[model samples]
Target: MVTMTVSHKRKDALKDVWDAVSSGWGSVTSGGVWSNAETEQEFEARLQRWENSGLAHEEAKRLGQKPPRAPRGWHKRQYPEIKRGDKAKYGVIGWARAVEVTRGANGWHVHIHAVLVLEGRQQAHERAYALGRSMHVRWNKGIAKRGFTSSKEHGLRVDVSEGAERQLAEYLAKAGEPEKAVRNSVEKAGKALAREATLGQHKIAKRGGRTPFQI
Candidate 1:
């Protein structure tokens, strides 16, 4: 019974995607997601490139010369390792994910928030840990292919909770109503269950920086 607000125009389309992901699920054992962070050197190099591009464009305009075209298809050039991981045999029964991006002192950050439904209920913690480790390894390899690297410790996070499934169901059911009263209630409850399945992206940022929402 997950509920979310939608425009009158896009409600039907959103529902179709939701139905496909959440149709058949008995229980949720663990919840997890993946993210990669850049090194300081990588950040500086990218920033320098951006600044240089801006300067070059300005110079060309002043001289009445044709401005250089910015690099194109960079995202396309980077191999999408996550897509391959999604197709791997990971004992995943059903899953849903949203790709998110934000910028901070560390530069642009891209990550995935996902809810994975597993096949069975026995030894849930052990299973979740194993899965998390495996995911971390796979993620590292994938990011390397794209010329990025993340810490082994902070790359992937998986949490196991006995009451995760019920809390998740409640959170999803209340998260997307347009009414002011309903939205307030959902926020209160969502913060209480943020570590479980809530999709709000207000987590505190590392390195003494504020998250995009905070800024």
Candidate 2:
């Protein structure tokens, strides 16, 4: 079964939860990470925009006016053609994401772990790689517009793999779990196996930093 937990901190999390539910049987999958350097002010401003959008929606509804259309988020705005079932474009049938935040020596670090389900077809690997590179380039440009910067090497990452639906599901499930719960579950599974299983399950932070759960 494709099991998972949901976090309401970001709207993207809910979308990811839906993707997990609807695309459990998908074949080829691609995983990605998008990150950038941000100061505390920039991070807070980002949160403010989310809050403002939500407030505007609520206010309009309460006033008996039609709620405004939600703004296309950064990812969608960057690639307006990423519609589900659009084979001519990216063939992105399903998408899921988990946003992680933690403080470190540099500052507050925020990044996204995303899983994309691709249509089953010939040359899936080539298609997946092309999409990843495109996302990386667009991501850099998008952040630049916001006055933030990211390194070419670490700003973005995308990896495509076939027949890993279950593994991807488990990774998303763990992303939303509390640190203590995940730790306990791993311990129950036995340290040796858990260590090996999680080796590539999530990305390690640069410079020996800890993930949200590890901190």
The candidate that wins on lDDT is 2
What's the TM for model 1? Answer: 0.40
Q: What is the lDDT of residue 71 in candidate 1?
A: 39
Clashing residue pairs in candidate 1 are 4-176, 5-176
lDDT of 1 by residue, 106-210 (tens): 444445455566666677567667766665555554444434445644556665545445544565577674466544544554343344334436566667655
lDDT of 2: 0.48
lDDT of 2 by residue, 57-138 (tens): 7788889999876545632443222123222355666665554554355544555555666777578778776766656554
Model 2: colliding residue pairs: none
TM-score of 2: 0.39
Provide the lDDT at 66 for model 1.
97
RMSD (Å) of each candidate, 1 decimal: 22.0, 19.7
Instruction: Evaluate all candidate structures by whole-model CA lDDT and list the values in order.
Output: 0.46, 0.48
Looking at candidate 2, the ten consecutive residues that score lowest on lDDT are 1-10
Query: lDDT score, residue 88, model 2?
Result: 34
Runs in model 1 deviating more than 4 A are 1-90, 164-198, 201-215
TM-scores, each model vs. reference: 0.40, 0.39
